[model samples]
Target: MTMSSGNGISFYMPRYDFTVRARWLERNARLIGVLKAAVPTQAIFSHVVVSGQTVGAVTRIRYDGPGVMVPRVFGSVFFYQPSQKINLCYGEITESATVNQFAEVIQEDLDALRDLGSKVWADTVANPVRHVVQVNIQEW
Candidate 1:
């Protein structure tokens, strides 16, 4: 899913059963909170790095602003599941304006995330998979 409001944010996840999907969605939301808490004190044109780990997940967040001459601020959060050997989720927010827009972007992303969670749940509940086929090969 992608949202464009003067800035752009996109979210993606692989298809899975409803129960599994819901668990992942909740985990992703929690990671977003972790990222927000890790925001640097002086975000404007500053270099900051924050990392945190939660149960079954690890997040790496970074904020970079080379100098006052530069007006762009780039931040990213990478959430990984080592046991699964895959990246559970990822989010990136960029602000080109002079002022800090990270807060607004994060808020928008969170709202969108909630919407997505609801949509996925509703979709799965409304239309559930109904099929069963178990094949067993016997050697004689």
Candidate 2:
């Protein structure tokens, strides 16, 4: 299943999952909006995947965009499992059953998802890591 926002951000997940948690996604539209604005550009594609009991919300640059080479970026608060603590990019958030409440919890985390998105973009483009190499000759 897929849901597209007016600003060119599209979300995808399994049809069964969507049927089960459609309301959750609907209630957290603001969170999706936050993700849409987290990146520098307006073209983003997000896919939600279910692994075991955890759900991950992954974002990537659109293929038609300038950042087509940019790797996928995940929301800071990606994993969501009822009755289990949701892990953040840097830490963990308290457990909750409803997705709406989860959004509230994330909001209390000072917009961690947005921060993570920006940081990933900066690290990938603005300030990429540089590797230095040194070689030494040895006699055996």
Candidate 3:
């Protein structure tokens, strides 16, 4: 399954069966949170960085669906390649550089989570909802 907003934001999954979606979210909660925080809406934040290092910007596009929420949050970094057109890769895929970059981003997000009086969970599912604040580290 693949979805796009035509602006910039894109989502893709190999299968449409979101029955295990919650499990998937739990596995990648930090990544999701970071991306969600990085890209709050249908706008692009350029020159994204954390602690003083540059990562990548977050881009939001047009979408008719209901607003994306934390619990219902569904954006992917591995399932699909971010693009204007909907493209389904059908499985988890990632590059070495992307992985390293994400590691840094997750670390930064984790620190922010702690500063906000939130517990860093070995399992993200345990993270409190109240502390799931959006990170504003965009250059634009």
lDDT of 2 by residue, 98-131 (tens): 2322122223333433443234334333455722
What's every prediction's RMSD, in angstroms? 18.1, 18.6, 16.8
Q: Candidate 1 — which residues are off by over 4 angstroms? A: 1-9, 12-78, 83-105, 129-140
RMSD of 2: 18.6
> How close to the true structure is residue 14 of candidate 2, measured as C-alpha lDDT?
26
Question: Which of the two, 1 or 3, has more lDDT?
Answer: 1
What TM-score would every model get versus the actual structure?
0.23, 0.21, 0.20
Cα lDDT tens digits, model 3, 13-117, are: 112211111112234444444444444333221221221122122344322322222211112223112431111111223422322111111222333322221
Alpha carbon lDDT of each predicted model: 0.26, 0.28, 0.24
TM-score winner, 2 or 3: 2
Rate residue 97 of model 3 by lDDT. Answer: 33
Off by over 4 Å in 2: 1-23, 26-105, 130-140
The numbered model that scores best in lDDT is 2
Error of 2 at 4 (Å): 24
Off by over 4 Å in 3: 1-24, 43-140
